[model samples]
Target: MSSSPAALSGGTVANPRSRVILASLIGTTIEFYDFYVYATAAVLVFPHLFFPPGNDATALLASFAVFGAAMVARPLGAIFFGHLGDKRGRKVTLVGALLTMGIATFLIGALPTYHQVGWLAPALLMLMRLAQGFALGGEWSGAALVATENAPAGKRAVYGTFPQLGAPLGFILANGLFLIIAAILPSDDPSRPSQAFLDWGWRIPFLFSIVMVAVGLWVRLNLVESTAFEKTVKAGKVHSLPLVSVFRTHTRQLVLGTFYMLATYVLFYLMTTFSLSYGRAAVNGALPGLGYDYTTFVLMMIIGVVFFGIFTMLSGPWADRWGRRGTLIGVTLAIIAFGLLWVPMLAGGTIGVMAWLILGFSLMGMTFGPMGALLPELFPANVRYTGSGISYNVSSILGAAVAPFIAIALWSWGGGSPFWVGLYLSAMAGLTLIALLMGTETRDVDIEA
Candidate 1:
């Protein structure tokens, strides 16, 4: 490989670019699967298995509160790992993050609940969740930047979408694993599963991360440091204080990127966690047979993940032509339209559920696909990692951290109307729209600092 700055800056798809994209996307997929499994468990099983049994509603909320605890720790993780990524290298930071996330997830599988260990259970559980949060804070932005920077100049948007697809892929695999478990367990209530499910089935999925971690470690270790980072280092131009430099130079970009992602995260948690519970409650109140079971819900998400993946794959080519700003703006507007239809689908039967799943997931694909390239584009090359990571994670905390709680509250307050959740999603999406209109476009900008 050429060592010249020009050679590094003139990236192309014909070389090892595909390999780099694959490495980032697969590693991120594995990491996110490990992360989202905990969120799913929090909503579905952790309250009963781990927490003290008091009021059912309060216990569930407490379980989700623990989920939010990790989001709170993400910003600190971003700063810590962002420093390493900028100064050291993307590969090294990712190596450490993968191990940390894997260990934390593995421990969650082995944990003893309140029945066995008393207060120590929730305490230990929270500690592990925070560790997971911290690791993931660094994982995504690093992966996205690696993929985008490695792509052939003309195909950056498309290559960028590869890493973004990891989100939907992770969701698909996580939910698919849970769906398999649900199907295999003797048909009773999901909350009160057959003895086999409670005895050991739940642990299987969490423990499965060990295999994925091993594979991710193998692939990532074999990969080279990103050419862009190496060029910056050779130029002696790497920011000594990336976090400070990022804020000072790119505050507006940071703010806009944060808003851009806010609604995406919010709607994501709502679709996966709160909707399941709300749908169940609605069925219980109305027609018992009309409610979607755990298996059905997971299956719907799988379908949505497929569409999300497809649309994300399509985003790159589109961005190269229409530009990242226009693509993102179009997607953002579509999301609001999707939100308007969310309630009718929830209140309706099987047809309605299918309609919402297809529409929402498709819209998710459109926004998320362009976001990988767009967010990193906001900052100059020197502090790209830190600025993008901080914006993404902070927005995650604001939009996603409390999404389930907010959606549930809305659903309950609105007397089971999914409309309120839609309204909440719209408001969050509206913020992104305003930010988009106000922010600068970077699609045609050069990557070199």
Candidate 2:
């Protein structure tokens, strides 16, 4: 008795394993590269270039406000793109999201600064930032589905990691480029970017998106739709309104999936955005920091993110073996521990900070990796795109969108101690742990069913 429903649906050639992996991986790499490029600049360049000259804290806060605003646009984009992905197909949706992000990023590169265009500078920047967020809202879930839907029996989690791998790769590439540019345009002072870097060098990464997006579009356009979605189409299971269908049928999973991803998002922004701010802020300022120069701190982040990539790849097999829920449970516990311990680590000076970074990023990877399969597994094929995108992006609003802003507030509250920030991370991880405890093991779930 043949039990391969995908095969029984019709005689269709399976998506080439390499193609599925590469398409999903490359698309997200480009998406995240665009995002992190903006993120790095929000910290390094935007405060000076976009906002009018003023109090440093107010300027930095304004920059972060624009940065967080993008997270608000994410769920909206998810709704639009999810509708398209579920109704049309993942391949076209992926290409559309990539184009959206690429164009926004490239345009941001060309935009005039506050000095050049006054209020229009920040307005244009916020508009492009929203577009980037919207594009990403649809990008991740589609890519995750591509990997998991194309996966062979018992290997969905492993295949799912392909998209997750993009986060670290994109972070490295984005920050690495900034570091190189900072080096090329050396500053008169050791602690800050050179005047040239401030003026024009930062735009290079944003402008470079055009080239990367071209490559992503090429790979994604070549992809055949995943068999699971193909089967959904043939069976006429595609919902006219996938968002309505998901909310009506999969409401419980939607809630669980959102909280389940909470800690991961919190840790991610804390480790990247908040850390860079904390690490480089002057030691004697109103909000005291470690006083490391900007270049040194970014270099440290690149080192930690290397571990993030390694563990992200490792999480696939681990989740495949132990199941997504179980693997995440363990990782979540570790995140809680790391959150509590990071205070001392930050105080331990450079080596301690590095240890804190490695530990934090490792936990980030382990927690972040499994969700590529875990979230999609929460719903059946017909609603997978919509359900996953909604859960993922809504959680972005709750977690990622507010994390940096909240962390900054907490940091200031504690007199730049970072104690409150670490505690805040622990608390979010606690919520995620509870959600994991409530979730079912999805490793063996028939996603196509």
Candidate 3:
């Protein structure tokens, strides 16, 4: 006699692998949106609202320092969450991280300004920002590993790119929201307008994430466990201590993977922070050069994000065909070459600004697109989450946390020559290139048990 339909369906559960990818993509996008919303606010609003003291330059620097503090906390988060994820399950760890980020972001939005609470306001903001950074440390690695591991044998790169796309996509929305808010306010009274922004306008973005978190939770709930991980567990190959396992067995992959991300990480900071500062400096000057205002500069970034998405979409198929190592190596060289154009175009003004943003973001997309697949693929299935998370986050210490400060110091100390900055970017790319060359290609690594 034929088995019942329910019995047959239960015999082989539907993959629901697509659900896993969708969940990772949506959840990551929301988490990053929350994190970067604060980043954009740190540059635009926090200096005046929270640190309204001393000279404008000093206040701005102080605000950036607080922003850097968040980055400093990220490695800690990586270690903490990385341990939890490796020991517990990926879903629960990610859920806790998301909740922390969402709540912190919401609290930031609702924070009392310095005017209302004296020193207490900024202190609270700093604390919340620290939480934000810590949460992000775990979020990226978990989502990337989930998406890639659930993907079909040959399509890991393509599936993995969806999670990476969240960064630029979130950036677009975060900055885009702020841009709209900034546009609506009347510019007739400059100080009053900015004061009004500090009081309430800046908080709107942070508050929006509360809604985002609810949505992310709903989507995440439906996700099934990763098939690769499931296989490892069933085979009794799951590591008791994933972090220790990675350090002991996959030391080379850990070191190389982190170093390999150096260029892209620094490039990410420059695109967001330094570029905004440069645009502001130009607009305040009385020159007919490419002195576009913040709105214009951000709009240019929006255009570039489109290309970022395209290049990311292209990476999946390209990596699957050319191999991940080749794609990563070629892109690193391209970034190095792009650095050569910095002095010429940045000195040229508006057109130059557009050129630089376009070129930099294009290279960013290519390199970042393949990394999600490449990094995890480097590790054996037993410790994939812990190995990839540690390498990815520890790399942040060298590559991202100090990149903007280093860039600014270079500009200040070089007597106005951005050549130092260009060299800095090039040096990072060169480091990553060496790491990639020395690493293994995991395109054909076994995924199924």
Task: Report each candidate's C-alpha RMSD, comma-separated, in the order given.
Answer: 3.1, 2.8, 3.6
> lDDT scores for all predictions?
0.81, 0.92, 0.78
> Between candidates 1 and 3, which one is better according to TM-score?
1
Q: lDDT score of model 1?
A: 0.81
* Candidate 1 stretches greater than 4 Å from native: 1-15, 285-290
Best prediction by TM-score: 2
- State the lDDT at 262 in candidate 1: 88
Ranking by TM-score: 2, 1, 3
- After TM-score superposition, what is the CA distance of residue 95 in candidate 3 from its true location, in Å? 1.5
Give the per-residue lDDT digits (tens) of candidate 2, residues 267-337.
99999999998898899988899998888888888999999989998999999999999999999999998
Error of 1 at 389 (Å): 0.2
After superposition, candidate 2 runs with Cα above 4 Å error: 1-9
Position 386, candidate 3: lDDT = 75
Q: Write the per-residue lDDT of candidate 1 for residues 56-175, one digit (tens) a residue.
A: 777778888888888988888888988999899888888888888898999899999889999999999999999999998998888888887777777778888887888888888887
Please report the candidate that would top lDDT against the real structure: 2
Instruction: Report the error of model 1 at residue 358, Å.
Output: 0.9
| TM-scores of all predicted structures | 0.94, 0.97, 0.92
